[model samples]
Target: MSEVPEVRPPTVTPVRVVIALCLIAPFVAMLWVGSYARTGPEFIGIPFFYWYQMAWVLISTALTMTAYQLWQRDQRARAARKDGASK
Candidate 1:
């Protein structure tokens, strides 16, 4: 009888860690409202409190996209590694 090979779980990589941070940043920023709750810095009449959150919306989108791309690349690399190991 032939025995099945063991499969190991993927290890954490720097790219994955960065991707996690990118994904969590927006959530943490919004949750910590004290960080941006202010009115002194206004952008063309918009209060800092409002504008900061609005700015994060765009920044969050970019971060999310970046994290997604990194995640895809990481997945591909892992897949390739698994294929190589299996062969």
Candidate 2:
């Protein structure tokens, strides 16, 4: 009897795409906002450029947190699959 090769399950490509977008969107938004703010006036009292960069700092933090959470979830799922396969 010939033995067939084992096939690995397909990866969650969509979820990975979503995670990448979530991580990249904020950075892209920040860049757009920065370029616009460079030519614009101060918002209320703060300088336009300064405020724009500061806003991005906060946004980047949020994006980083989201990425971390997604990575953790992915890791957990992978671990669970590994554990199941080992059983």
Candidate 3:
């Protein structure tokens, strides 16, 4: 009887770490309310708290885009590796 080899998950890479950070940074910043709860700083009469959240809306979009791009790159690299290994 032949034994089947176990397939292990890929190890974490620096690219993956950066991708994770890109995805998680917005959540962390938004969830950590106390950090931006005050409204002392005003921009064009807008309170800091409101403006900060609004700013994050754009920031989150950019981060999400970056994460998506990184994820696609990682997937392509993994696929190439897998194909090479199988060849």
Candidate 4:
């Protein structure tokens, strides 16, 4: 049988880093906004602190979706490599 060429999967560190940043950025922003609650006016009819935290709910969802996509891609690549090796 012909030897199957070794397939090197793309590095996932960057994807993980991006996901981490996505998760962290909103949290940091929320904290900053919360700190302003002692002084700042309401945001979009809601309290600054409340809206800030609520904003993160959507951001977290998006970040989770991104992470999931990255994981799925990695899995598909691994599966393809295995399939190739068995051929």
lDDT of each: 0.91, 0.75, 0.89, 0.71
- Best candidate, lDDT-wise? 1
**Model 3 alpha-carbon drift over 4 Å, by segment:** 1-9
What shift in Å separates residue 69 of candidate 1 from its native position after superposition? 0.3
In the range 5-86, model 4's lDDT, one tens digit per residue, is 7766666567667767766776676667446565246786776666767777888888778877876776787898889877
> Which pairs of residues collide in candidate 2?
none
TM-score pick, better of 2 and 3: 3
Question: Each model's RMSD to truth, in Å?
Answer: 2.0, 2.9, 2.5, 3.8
Local lDDT at 61 for model 1:
99
Q: How close is every model to the real structure, measured as TM-score?
A: 0.86, 0.69, 0.84, 0.60
Model 1 Cα lDDT, one tens digit per residue, 1-87: 999877865578899899999999999999998898789788999999999999999999999999999999989988888898899
Which candidate, 1 or 2, would have the higher lDDT against the true structure?
A: 1
Residues forming the 10-long window of minimal summed lDDT in candidate 3: 3-12
What would the per-residue lDDT of candidate 3 be over residues 1-87, giving only the tens digit for each residue? Answer: 996574544679899999999988999999999999998799999999999999999999999999899989989988887776666
In candidate 3, position 84 carries an lDDT of 68
Candidate 2's TM-score reads 0.69
When 1 and 2 are scored with TM-score, the better candidate is 1
